[model samples]
Target: MVDTDSVTGTAKELAGKVRGAVGDLIGSDRDSVEGRARQVQGTAERAYGEGKDALRETADRVADAGADARDNAGRYYARAEESVRNAADEAYHFAEDAYDDGGRYLSEGRRAIAQQVEESPLAALLIAGAVGLGIGLLINTRR
Candidate 1:
């Protein structure tokens, strides 16, 4: 496309030169001046077309770079998301194991307390009263 425009402009320039020469030979100053103006207009138009072509090419390159950058960013985000999901899954399993261990410990503690209460009712009552007092004090402090 650029080559075609360049060729057309060159042809126009040559035609203008020939017309100007003919007008000069015929002693027509107006025709000669008009031919010169045509030549100048053709040159300006060709320059404008070249500038436009350069700008268009630059815009296309920039767009292609932007698309590549976006694609790379998307890939990175997907990988990061997968890593976070895997980490979350591992944490969930760890928490479940900890909960199971805590439950077992609590069960054993409850059994020991029951045996002690059964062996000594008076001691059990005293301990229960002490625990209640401590809880009441904690509540009062919060208030």
Candidate 2:
């Protein structure tokens, strides 16, 4: 009962077809001609309404597609942001592990050097002298 033009026209067209048939059966030329004219008018009106409906449907679909694209873009951005955050966390943890390893190595090296110096003071002194001599020679060459 929305009374869309297409529905109204379709009803009229059916009525016209029935009237035309009845007129033909009863041998009334005037009634038959009028019914055929009405049928043609109804068909034109129905076609016009159908064209409008098609255009409206196409517009609605276009709007929906635009909305869907925007939503998909938002989802993609969120996923990319999450990926970046996860990668940063992984990189930070990796750097922290490396820092800890470096600290441990430095501590071990210090302990080893202290032990060596305590075990042999004379050898430690000799090694220190050799290092100083080497540095002096390098500097003299640069000069």
The candidate maximizing TM-score is: 2
lDDT of 1 by residue, 47-136 (tens): 445544554455555566788765665565556545545554554455455546656776888899999999998999999999999999
Local error of candidate 1 at residue 30 (angstroms): 1.9
User: What's the lDDT for candidate 1?
Assistant: 0.63
User: How far out, in Å, is residue 112 in model 1?
Assistant: 99
**Total clashing pairs for each candidate:** 0, 0
**Model 1 misplaced stretches (Cα beyond 4 Å):** 3-5, 67-143
lDDT of all predictions: 0.63, 0.66
What TM value does model 1 have?
0.40
